[model samples]
Target: MLNFQNKNFYQSLLNLSLYLFVYYYFVRVVYVYYKLAKYISLDFYRVALFVPAVIFITLAAYHYFKNIQQLKNNIYLNSFLSLFAIIVLSIIYHFIFRLDYMSDDVFSYQIKNLSYSILNALLGFYLYQQLNSNSSKKIIFVVWFFYAIMLLINLNGFALDTKGVSGVHLMLGDTFIIISIVAIFMNINHKILKIISLSAVLILAYLINSRSSFFSFLVVYLFFLYKEIGLKNLLYLFVLMFFVAFALYYFDLLRINKRMFGVFQGHSDGSLNERMEQFKYGIEAIKNNWFFGEFAGQAIVHTQGYRSGQMGAYMHNWLSYYRQFGLVFFVIFTLMFVYAGLFILKEWYLKNTPIKNMLYYLFVFEAVSLLVFRAYSFTHVWLVMVMLYSYIHDKNIKNLSEKA
Candidate 1:
């Protein structure tokens, strides 16, 4: 009886770990933390954001002390070393160069922001670890339940109070819910439950009306169907797309919106045009500081007197790394993402993991949509990328081990 109890306890812990990953990566856990912290005090936001970091640090220390044998594993050591190096380098560059924009220019405040970013990345890694665990189904279900609650709250007008309703949040949340539904379909044996789960997700996506997410879902769904339905059916999909485009065009919504379809049309007013102006200025800044570009946070300072409030803000372009960090750093950063993408693809193809293949396809669809929508940074793209890499890497390792 005692042994059985102990097994259940460990299983619960493992399940919680997996849920945390899905929660942290897809849901606005940080935003939720911020909302709760706001009632405590404005200062609490910083403390709240640091909570995950503090916990992760404690876990690392505990593992070092209690699991010394496991600590000696080269894979664990290398991941730590690489992560440490990246964090240190990014910090040095951000501070020495002043790479981000903040209302507070204090070094400690900047450190807090960097810590937040790193904490987010670590949370993403934790999620990856949990998702790959054997008991992932339980974890996925818990995450989905909490996610549904959050969605209900948001829909009912309980805004997170951190940032306003953003396209990024909507997209990431919808993606997670969609993926969770898919996982349920794969793992759950009940046919009726699977159909219900899928139907619920489809309804929820439509109700949300997140144009990018809705279109992305359609694209990926068609891709899946194409694989199942053959070339003749695929041609019909293209024809359908053409008619959809024509209808949207005939209505003048496409021209008036200036975005692909009408998905990004929510902020299509002058805001997008303003972003374009900012992008233009950002390009000019890049040209001017071509070598060791301006510090991260210094752009706001440089253009402080500009009439455009948004222009005197941290530019949204992911390419800002090039403008602020320099070509070398930007190249390295781009290479890292490219390597992650290729690694995901290679593993998916080699291992024939259907889940990983679906995830890779989703990421590819999202990446393309980002180019068209400029909504990547606002969403959980970084977390999603890390999760995809982790999923593919673990699947590949498992396959290789089985073969060996």
Candidate 2:
């Protein structure tokens, strides 16, 4: 007998399928970024992985919607739909009004952005529904473990090329480390596995010499540590870290790339310089079109060197939103996230748990990344935002039911 009504079975299936699809996005973006078409055509993965992922996701979603409660007054759903409407409207406005301003490459990037936005939103909602379960955390950790192992297997292949690029390291390392940190704190049974994953991710981050990623990881880890452990314990741990760092430095074993550490000494790398230039240009663009949006390729058109004439060469922050989507979209999205964050903090204050702490840590990570590191279009940021909002919404509903 097929137990079509079994929630546990469907939830497990959904978790496996959904994360596979999400991580496939990671791999796909890597392939595209590195131009690894000779290794495997993107179309090949689309047919082999994407098709089945979508179909399974659809089946799982059908079960979820059928079994779940009605969305008669779902504030989160309404908020998401409103934000998505703004996204669609902004895209249409750009396409219609800024047609002559955008080159072919710019148009292609916009199309990719639109498609990825929709896909990430759908994934976020599915994970939101799944995450309310007790086992979902374990399932997520297991999936991360699998991906971390795969990364270890292919570590050398993703090493810095002639370009001296560490974007892959920053992306993959930060992704795994944040999850591993949360999992380590939440799932005591999987402590060893989480430690192994975190170690691998740190190794990658160090070897690739991604300073921003290491800094981000340190900040979030310390924040969560302070929350879980008291300030006194954290200070003791800091003293221990200082000794460890001193020992490594004294042994001449801590050989971080000079360029990676140079930022602290006011010496900037080419990439840093480029980002500074983009920031300057982005600020100016914002000033010019403070109320409305600017053209898509205006950053490229205005810049003179170092990623000059590049399609997506813009600020790697929320400023990217203002430049592309205008002040209205930026304000609305920022407010949505800020409100979600505040709501989460309120809930956490009322009742803090390992799982809630993990969610807060994830929120802090994404918030930090978007402020200075990642571009506005980065899909994972949207996923994290939606996940946080979903958590808050679920908690709100639970509280209301309890009162009744």
Candidate 3:
């Protein structure tokens, strides 16, 4: 009999990398302890920032190569190719503009981190899709366990508590929490565990105070639960939501964080204004460089950031990428999303089952989340979507084989 429960080396590595990603998110907390050393702290970031990323990518690359015996096809090639094009263009623009300073900016400084994230996401989903039920369940559970550990640390006050990250970094880590909720709902046998798991996700989102993350989880979570358990049972859950919201407000937590919410309040906190300014700056930069936007000179982000102390100093999402990379990059990116969307739809329609149905909604929810968050900048969005589609596609192929 064929074994359906074997965990391969690559699968194990993928699971371990997921854990490391969670741990990397907490590195700033470790930095606080090291900050008191009063000695050289440069090596700390070098180790803390680069090591986890390097390990994850190295493992992921090996895993992808080792999985030749398995079935392939993760989303579409256009997505990956387009991202490659962007990276290339980003590189070319970096030099053509002759802006050496651009290489030292936050994104450039963390290019390896970005590359590692993208590579792991793409490769991880590819391997995860072909996993047998037992193996997939183990992988999901392992990933969820990491999230649970982080939550426990947060509850224990050991977490850095959002001080370590803001902007795009938080967006990257937040997706893991979203997937952890999904994993619990799917894998946990108990009903209460599922609900608590979801509630924990919302609480984490609230604690982070990311408007996009909170709203994305709220929409997807309530919608899914409403479908799963009906509205009558969700009243208590609604109460939970109310209390969480009330606590965040009553304790005046939003004041400390909160971005993109100043227009209606008759105030300018530099968050919302800065994003709008980014659009303005993008428009202005396009006219000067035309091909690569503002990769060079006084028009670049750090310059604008230094001048304005603004929030969104760079392209925020896929649409925003148009501002930096011109129309060609934007069209390629939009096409990639369309192609990925079609694949998910095809798989769901072919299967027409509950799990496949749920995946459809999940993909859509993730799409909305990435649009709100940073789509390409944060790789988890791509990772989660590709993982879901890979499973769906594999099932579709298996079904066709059985039918034939």
- Give the top-scoring candidate (lDDT): 2
Q: What is the TM-score of each candidate against the true structure?
A: 0.64, 0.81, 0.68
Give the Å shift of residue 55 in candidate 2.
4.4
lDDT tens per residue, model 3, 1-404: 11223467545655555555444434443344325335647676667656755666676566555553452444443455566667666756665654544445544533543574575465446335333355555666676666556544653231235444334325433655545544664566565776676677666665545666666677767765775687987888779867886898788753433243444566666665565666566666666666654432223454534543222355444545565556676676666656657776786556544345445556666666656545344555555555664664566678888999
**Which is the winner by lDDT between candidate 2 and candidate 3?**
2
lDDT of 1 by residue, 1-404 (tens): 00123544444444444544554545445354334445556455445434544766456445445555544554533453464455457557665655344323344644554554454454445555555554575656666666555554555222222245344455444455445543653365554564455445544454454445555555555544454456797689679968986997799743332333343545454545655666776677778888666544323533455522122344555665566556665656566566666876676556544456546665655554554443213434555555665565566668888999
Against the unseen true structure, what C-alpha lDDT does each candidate score? 0.52, 0.64, 0.55
Q: Locate the minimum summed-lDDT window of 10 residues in model 3.
A: 156-165
Clash count, predicted structure 2? 0
Clashes of 1: 7
Query: How well does candidate 2 score on lDDT at residue 80?
Result: 67
Off by over 4 Å in 1: 1-16, 22-52, 61-87, 93-102, 105-113, 132-135, 145-218, 234-268, 297-317, 346-354, 369-379, 391-404
